[model samples]
Target: MRTKQIANRFREVILDGLWIANTNYKDQLSNITWEQATTRVESLNTIALLTFHINYYIEGVLNVLKGGALEIRDKYSFDAPKITSEEDWKILLNSLLDNAEEFASLIDTMPDEQLDNYFVDEKYGTYQRNIEAMIEHSYYHLGQITLIKKMLSNE
Candidate 1:
């Protein structure tokens, strides 16, 4: 039950369905062009950068969920690959969406009891803490992406 709720929240942020913000990553990013995604707004990070940043943690946590190591680092989270063309942008977006789905799916199948277990190490807190943090973090960047899109459109 708890796991399902957490997974659903994850899905609601990245994939289909909307409960908190009324918009998901797929919906918000579907019509965004490569040019717009890569466009800069003052010192703000580009939409593409935010997208990559969000997925960085998702993929890292995802690996841990799949019985792998916690290999992501904060310093390298924004080291997004260059988006040189529409194909490049599409590839990045697709990867994010794909990983997001997989991440949520893994969480959905997670045993509720596992949520209490420490993730990677004690310093990182429990699986539930990290998962919830991902959801919140995604939402934070999602808002930035939406605002960046609007700023780009207005320019």
Candidate 2:
């Protein structure tokens, strides 16, 4: 009984993260290109990069939580899509949405104990911390996506 309750709560957080990913930002982040998105006022991070960053870590945490191996990539930490056509941007946004759902499926099956397990030297945090932190991480980029959209609209 208690396990189901805890699982439901964690499921809610994961669903919230997915909701943050799939919204439209006044046409700013949803369906735009890096070339179309770049601006002197905007850092190269752009909406596309932000989408990729959020999804990358999301996939990382989800895969790791489900006992899959992790991969390394050079994203928002060092550099990002400085030049991309509109088509590329749409592809990325779609991928993020698709993976967001995949992560949701992963969460749907999480055992309560798995949520508390410690995987040494594996992910950004212990399993519980990873799940908790994903909420903040996804929302942080969602906020960036929202702000960039606003900046683009204003320009």
Candidate 3:
């Protein structure tokens, strides 16, 4: 029930089927070239960097969901790899989408009761909180990606 809802929310933001926002990461990033994604718009973070940042948390939480340790760090979230070529950009985009699907699938299988349990530690709050934060956080960056794309197109 709750897990399904959380998973749906995550899918809505990262994959397809728009609900809260009219777009998703796959929809936004699929057509962007490596040059466009890596282009700087003023002092804002590039679309590639933003994409990596969003996936960083998803992959981290996914590790814990899969019974691994929480190994993600804030300082390293934006440390995106250099997307020097079309292949590099494609790899990062594919990884983001793939990890997002896996993360959502894992959430979909979680028992409702597990959502109330601590994620990796009490400091991080419950699974529900963390998952919700992921959705919200993804949306926040998704908006940025959309704007950055628009800015690039206008240039």
What are the per-model numbers of colliding residue pairs?
Answer: 0, 0, 0
> Positional deviation of 135 in candidate 3, in angstroms?
0.3
Tens-digit lDDT string for candidate 3 (99-121)? 99999999999999999999889
TM-score of 3: 0.98
Per lDDT, what order, best first?
Answer: 3, 1, 2
lDDT of 1 by residue, 11-80 (tens): 9999986788889899999999999998999999999999999989999999998989888999999999
Q: Relative to the unseen true structure, what is the C-alpha lDDT of residue 149 in candidate 2, on a scale of 0 to 100?
A: 69
Best of the two (1, 2) by TM-score: 1
Q: What's the TM for model 1? A: 0.98
TM-score of each: 0.98, 0.70, 0.98
Residue 44, candidate 2: how far off, in angstroms?
Answer: 6.3
lDDT of all predictions: 0.92, 0.58, 0.94
Model 2 per-residue lDDT at 68: 78
The runs of at least 3 residues in candidate 2 whose Cα sits more than 4 Å from the true structure, single-residue gaps closed, are 1-28, 31-36, 40-44, 73-83, 120-124
Residue 76, model 3: Cα distance from true site in angstroms: 0.4
Clashing pairs for model 3 are none
Per-residue lDDT of 48 in model 3: 96
Pairs of residues clashing in candidate 2: none
Candidate 1 residue 33 Cα shift, in angstroms, is 0.7
- Badly placed stretches (over 4 Å) of model 3 are none
Q: Is candidate 1 or candidate 3 better by lDDT?
A: 3
In model 3, the Cα lDDT at residue 74 comes to 99
